[model samples]
Target: DAGVTQSPTHLIKTRGQQVTLRCSPKSGHDTVSWYQQALGQGPQFIFQYYEEEERQRGNFPDRFSGHQFPNYSSELNVNALLLGDSALYLCASSDLGTGGWAYGYTFGSGTRLTVV
Candidate 1:
């Protein structure tokens, strides 16, 4: 399988607006991760809802939030958008049973968000 999928291939929003993005994990993967990629740079971690209450996050502010459902799918929400928020939103899935990223994450092309 592709491992992950994201919606709204491209998005445009005004500053201060809110946005919600969706993701579906790869089969048998119980962990979902989100990342933000800016121009000419690698993706920056946003957050991850893993097995149990083990949650990992990056330096993002409260404006970013995420959730993982029983089905292992997830949603990423961003509030009070800023021009700096414009970038590619990436989703990755991994099987923690075999040591999460130890097995490498399967990622999608990502959703492009442009905050005006």
Candidate 2:
């Protein structure tokens, strides 16, 4: 009955450094997705994973990468971090092919990354 979980609730990194965020999906979930939300802005899709493969991606740079594990856990990695990269990184999990209002994704509290 646990929801999605993200590690390292907060992080600080210097510009040009790299960072990795971790996530564990909700029970019975198979798909995992990542999003970035800046202050005063809504969440922006980063990418999605299904069957341990990336199924979809948004307009993020190549520096952004992700991986999904067999157990439905996932990881998000950012390289050459910039000040603009500072934001709340969210991980959402849901069952694929179960699209509808009643089967919405469950999101984690998110990892706050600050690039100084």
Candidate maximizing lDDT = 2
Q: For model 1, give the 10-residue run with minimal summed lDDT.
A: 48-57
Question: Which residue pairs collide, candidate 1?
Answer: none
Residue runs of model 2 more than 4 Å from their true location after superposition: 100-102
* lDDT by residue (tens digit), candidate 2, 27-109: 98899999999999999999999999999999999999999999999999999999999999999999885771258889999
Local error of candidate 1 at 73, Å?
0.4
Which whole-number lDDT from 0 to 100 does residue 108 have in model 2? Answer: 100
TM of each candidate vs. truth: 0.94, 0.95
Off by over 4 Å in 1: 52-54
